[model samples]
Target: MNQNYSKKCAPRRLMTVTALAAFLFAPASASLFAQAGAAASANSPAADSARSAARAADPLRGTPSTITSAGNEARTQQDAFERSHRLGLRFYNGGADATCEVALGRICYWNNNGDVPPPAERADARLEREALLEVLAKAQRENPKDDWVNGMRVRYAIEGGQAEVGLEAARACGGTDWWCAALQGLALHNLNRHVDASAAFGRALAAMPEAQRCAWDDLTLWLDPAMHANYKALGCSGRGAENARVFRLGQPLWMLPGNDLQNEWYSRFTMSRVHSLGRLPYDMQWGDDLLESQLRYGWPTAWSVQNGGAADPRPPQVVGHEPTPSYDFMAVPSGIGSPTQATAKDWEPTRKKARMRYSTRYAAGYGALPHQFARFLRGGDTTILAGGYRLMRDLEMGRAPYTAALTLDGFDGRAPLQVVRDSAPANSALLVPFSSTMLASVEVLAPVGKRAARVRNTVSPLPRETRLSDYLLLQRGDPSPTPTLERNATQAYGSTEIEGGTTIGIYWEMYRQASPSAPLQVSLRATRLGASFFQRLGSSIGLSKALTPVSIKYNDNGRPDGGAGRSLTLNFPSVPSGDYQLTLMVSGAGVTDSTTQVVRVNSGNK
Candidate 1:
């Protein structure tokens, strides 16, 4: 128990702080899904009245079940109300037309709740027709160059099989243009056109502005958890990317030199490219917790569209997940046993040491410290954690006689300290520092007995040439297991054979060692032609499916490893009877490399 430092806050101050916290770092709720089955309860007048009131307050939104018990009841209710309104605005007001907005809003609301309006009343259905048209018309009349508007128009055309119209619109709208370019890309894609679509999408990426990008970045970081989740649930990966393009419009943006964009940015960096970081459909506890904390306490103003919004305005959110070079020394203890070491795993120790990969990153800091620190982390001598989070406490360098206790909050509903390590007279193990202002640390129980393992620094200080894998992973979610086909490593990119209609599956991991958080993007395509050709063709054809787009965002508090790890799945329908090839890309923050596998398909299966 610590002393209360601040004066007692007024209800409004408390509300604002609580709201801010919810906005910055609220966790996603499993109960959100359960609400779907819990409709307005028309059978009860009181329940019906509550539902009607909710609808009036926010035409399309649902209440998140994950409420903080620590806060006052009024505060909690107020936070919930504000969050619901924000969701309504994000889904219903932020898009092309009322219908699309509402439909998306419905999806968002339903994501946490089971009840959804019928098809006729579905906002998505209406948006698919009228609202999209309105947006297109508005773009054409007022801001034809606006990429977002044009992009939607183009997409509607492609989906409606109006390939010619789509191409014209795309041609008229440059990639640097906002939604317009997205629309053109989508339209071109529908007509079995890949090259044009790729170019369109490329232009969109290239034309993006740094300032707009900055704003969008803010939105992703600060937007409410419920709102963010609803946005992702709308199958809006490409849309979000396209939106990001809108933000980055008019900026001399450059993607990794290779044909891949999704993989390059999202995967290499392990930052979520599609979904908002710390949003839903992601179940990891730490990520959720950290996100909640960020929402409540981090620099959310930075994430606001109006302000220099980023997830936080505070100094770079410290990564507590893993170890880095900033600290004098960091230690990570892992019990590596063979696949089936049976019960005698840790004890049946052979001399074989488990080779662990630590992901590392440096926050953009001014002066000599941050940059020098980055250099230090990359110097190949600094040891980092698996997903680049915590800096291990260096028992070797730090003064001894210090103890650290790990405390987990949610499970027991009490702040119980877990593991405590004490250093000898002159030295102590590594101490993990909390760095991210956007995320908070939930003290975890430190393991006992096992000597704190030394983190081996392996980053090479190589010249910064265009590393394809690195760039790709930076663009998308965390990469797959293996990167390029290095002769030394046993795992190499593989090949698969498929019939025309046969489905192919893709897999990968999203790891962030620091805050139990990592955002990711997953995409799969086949290059019957060369990579470039397929990319272009895919873009032109508007064949990219949002459902198939793989992107997982990291969270703050549950798992130290940013528990964004998962096996992504991609399925392809029957293609034309020709020799076809496939490419799958995954990316995220704190991820170093991406893995690719090629597969061939024949027409007989179709």
Candidate 2:
């Protein structure tokens, strides 16, 4: 239960970017969880003035807590609220004396009647929540400075899927302190304003004591023991950048939209505080099951009651607890491998599968976007990173051009080696000048829609001494009548997916070849890719030739000028349509190099 995360929330001061500050709202006075820094520490009158000024500058820093309700119902509700928490005190020992966290949501079902409600008999609980909110809204008007009144309104709004309402309530909370910052962060997160939400959450964490702050820093809550060990050994150090890299790698499907994992941290912060004193039948602490379940698999998207059909319905063993029931591909830490691994070359499909167990799964995830990338030698030292990223059809519902950013990141996923941004139609390309040969992750982000797609490919740059640059795949795209060696990274077909009747352009450089006219051996072979195990075995043993391989071999006479560029074409073969692999190899005096890639063919060939 005790963790080192119980240290300073973060070590650095927050710097709000100019552009981001432009969208922020005017600050108000702080209440329960407010602080006025050194300015408010001065003598009486000066301290009061400084506290007032500080509230105008930041939401989490200000005066002491004294939120009084005006008259009758307002005062009675306040008393009732504290009394309601009386029973909760028996379970949640966290304390109201210190800490900005308070569970504004109802966590217990006293009317369980010792049985889980059957699906047909279950009433819509949200309706009751809605009705109560109507009264709370009225009370909020009467007691504009009351923290409890406003905080409850914000909670109901967020859980009820009314993000804008939540934001309104959060902003209205009299105290511009922890309650304000945290409530606003959750609201902004639901609105997909991650930058702002992160800022707000940062402020809330700043208000917490070291112990509580550290508990919120733990990222291994969702990991199984083995994966948790592997993850913890990653040496994250709780730095902002390090945590970001970890979150990026943990995205279940990079292609899916929204920074779900990032939002999840703040989401857990709120949930932990609410369920801190959970009630339960488990032998261990109450709420431990819910905590363990959420930490490991993430919050479930939906819940359905399974009746005690065969057993006695008494004592209601069934609860409204259900993990994501959909078959999904959970995201594990990617891009950056272990502290020991580097370069994309060290990554393979097998290792990816092995690590997948640690990722938290989700339903209704985003679809994969097509992409293509190639590295070409640039000025001997620099490498030209050219890539094409496409927004899937469903996501490309508008004419507004999509922005694509291509970034070459280091082994630690730290400072990027190079980053290039460009905008185009649904299909976009980015060509960046890079100069790294170590392990790296080439990432592309198509940030659009409610949930979008992100792609990160880990790779080891080809040795600078290699005899060939990566073979670039191209196609005659829209508005381009003829395919040429010249390319528009943004317009290039990211992947070789063409009608079987069309031809795809192939480009590569024959490095260190003999003289320009010297004879060299060239071989281009097309084989079955994405075939079944038995089919692949047949090809391996010469057992089947249903789709004969496309083989081209020739001798080339060339005196190379650093073998910077060369061009060729490969047409889709006449075969049952699916996917195929094309490999090209060029051999000179004592040097040889080859590249292979899969091309999807859409036409059916008998």
Candidate 3:
């Protein structure tokens, strides 16, 4: 769970090749949330006098001698780059005769890339699926000189619905089968398919052979460690080992290793011990680096295609107040053609130049609040003020606090999902008014009674635009057979509603996708609002970041630049008097969004 994600509470780069320093750690079954480890050594006092003179010249006093001469010069340049790119072992040519016709195991290209026909409603009373469809119809009537088990019996006769009997059984079974023409172009893309699954994954990537086109994109990222060692060496325990650990946690070489760990060295020794192995058996499969570089750098995290416009849409309600409880998937609406009418003089300056181009991509992902504000709640307490929570747990155990977490589930009604605090006395939650910009205030809390709670706020985003994969997507994970491709900028919840005296407000316009590959989650919800003319426009303006609590009952005690002020009074008689709620949860490096509001105590009350 430590792939060093930065970009906000970010900065991690430790990779000492030789003298060994690959500690990593973060995949131990997703480390049960709440994390902020590995990051406390900022050369203080010259690194405590160089670790007290390398611990008095070492006797293994925590291994020293200038850190073992910089880990033997990084293990002699990682053994001269693995002895100049070694490359010896290479066999599995016919892929163990296509894993002895699947009854055995090994040749795994995303799971047997073939064989699956006997289903026309179990073709008349199945007796072991009609003797395994009479041994796959006598291996397609003996057309087998084994070109990878007759290219898995022509991809199980074009996925069974037989595209012209799998192109007449691959033209009466051909010889140089490149998986029988990628199973007759994937049995004509399983019937209702697209120009044949794109001409069968593009003629299986043009029958490879152009020096194996980067070995078939490194064998499509070794489709999860050779399909979890050929489904546990074919015993297939009814698809066991927890279904090969969900196809090796959805493969991609668990985010950037290579040659599928030297052609399977026990799946790179189980991805070097899956972050110190934990999590009872699964959950976390190697931690962050944009999900282990999308499984060993194969990249492309997810894609489903076929978007004939609108299907699973409704989701686009971002504007203010969100203390959790949101999921809007861009709120649908793309019906495509027919609906033109412009011409009110070219639609009023093209709707003001498309509202200044979506407000400059929403102010390039938002600003304000860059460190200096802490008071966490919802279980593990942490408090800091104007540099609070003990300087934010000394920047979460030294440099890096925005750890990350926010989950809200399905609601029941009166909306306004709760978790608000700072009942006045200065715990500000968005006030802004003073004019020419810059008077910001945002506070969302939960503490005092904590009703059926499930909120996790680990702030830190003002640190010069946040990155390093947004601090390795906030650590905690493990269990590995290599396969990683995560993208959840943080915002997970399911059941909702938990009110408190309410008051809400928000104004955001952020965006950043100039080729963003992942990282985005912005959720915000809020209700309870009587506005009170926004407290008479925060006393006719002087917006000193809000907090005026004590005791003023003012129809006129006068201060907020007095000029045109009346009825408002709050001056901190030690502040904390009643009803509350506030929410905001923005994310990047997995993109996320959120907003919510509420706050009370007004009849000139204190």
Candidate 4:
């Protein structure tokens, strides 16, 4: 036997013998034995049948069938071993091995005794510690220089709050073992040697396999400011290193205005990089839930573009579905007169009609607008402009433009409409466009409702130069709109109504000739009505405090077409049941504009 191991075992052996005697003679031993007998009886056929019936009635029961045969005895023993092992590590449970029958009995007794060991049972806990020391000493004697045994000794010492001893044992392992390194880190951390602890933790993480890393590893690294700071300083060099760096740098920027914008930023910094790193699938990832919640519960209205005018905003269901691509442009169906129409040359008219047909087929085949955008980006269709005015129009109005343009070509719309659904999948080809022959047979189909009249009034016989600058105003209830473009725009509320704990949604579009990359400052302010008394008091006191407005500031990145839009909901700290004026002011590129609306806040009773 190793001299050092023998010295450790000598006191442990004496303690173990005394513990064994006490365990055998304790008054509670009789009760424990009786309980064991009862447990054995409980595993009988009748008891098993009752258990099986209970499991059958349990809605949340696992898929596995209940075991009632002799196999159940083995399972019971296995469960007892697992339970005893866990309890032994946390609280002393007599000196029984994890798999020992006595350990199992002690576990059952402790559980039956309400998880609290009585004063008399405290002796058993001491015995369990002695047994553990004896077992560890024997293992050390078998292999005194084994790094794993030494690491385990360090863990045991740390668990017993002997941080200094744990550190000494950990040093003996030479930091090769991950557990020893981890224990050393913990000891150093407790001693306020943060820099040393961080180094030790980094070494431990380096030694651990990626698959073996658990929540505890993340918790330890994140919860320790010193460790996290060290990791940020030195740890980003592997496959996902760039992603980690970007996330840390960009999380602060996720406070942008809209959920869509915030999600775009978040996806760009985190999800996209994660996908690029092959850690997660691109389409399967989702954005921050809080942002999504804000969009859904804070603003519930739709904003739809109207020809030659501000968008006719409506509730979500009334607007149906409209796809908003990454560009700003307007499209009017054929036969409609537009304010910015260009005179069509002989060849230009035929080509314009053909482009409309192509966009229709593209939309039907792609199932999504972004897929079409991707194709445009790839230079797949060189005939189409990089900006692809034709594709943009088709996307903005769905099939409305193409069907309307084709109707004027002296062909029935039935044949071309049939082929809309017949086009191959967007992913089937590298580049797919509607064949010229197919376009020749197509005719334009007019859109329904006021949209038809608007289209007819706006469509030019020739290509037109249209400026994209336009303003839009929209409002909804307290809850926000959903994040998706198709679902976001809700119908504008006719009468503003406010109640207890309700917020007011304000949305607007500001058109400006400014750099798209520049930040536009927008402010939302609310002024309570009935300021006459304050105005009079201010006049008398020579202090102009009347009509003080509560406001919040937001920074917006100007849009692609020198435009900026915002949908924000506001709540006042203390709003009595009365009337108020809500105003939104936007400023950028040496210009500013403000719009105000009156709202009636009702008391809780009505």
Best by TM-score: 2
- Alpha-carbon deviation at 539 in model 2, angstroms: 11
Per-residue lDDT of 22-54 in model 1, one digit per residue for the tens? 212111222211122233232358965874665
Candidate 4: list runs displaced more than 4 Å: 1-127, 130-138, 141-148, 174-179, 205-536, 539-606
Error (Å) of candidate 3 at residue 528 is 3.1
Write candidate 3's Cα lDDT for 272-298 as tens digits. 222222111112222333223223322
| Predicted structure 2: lDDT | 0.48
For every model shown, the clashing-pair count is 156, 30, 102, 32
Report the alpha-carbon TM-score of model 2 versus the true structure. 0.62
Worst 10 residues of 2 by lDDT: 1-10
- Candidate 4, position 313, lDDT: 27
**Model 2: per-residue Cα lDDT over 308-388, one tens digit each:** 234532221222222222112233444343522433332332231121112222222233456666777656667676666
TM-score for each of the candidates: 0.21, 0.62, 0.20, 0.23
Pitting candidate 1 against candidate 3, the one with the higher lDDT is 1
Once fitted onto the true fold, the runs of candidate 3 whose alpha carbons sit more than 4 angstroms away are: 1-132, 135-137, 145-177, 180-203, 208-527, 530-606
| lDDT-sorted candidate list, best first | 2, 4, 1, 3
What C-alpha lDDT does candidate 4 achieve relative to the native structure?
0.31
For residue 594, model 4's alpha carbon misses the true position, in angstroms, by 23
lDDT of each: 0.28, 0.48, 0.25, 0.31
How far residue 430's Cα lies from its native spot in candidate 3, in Å, is: 25
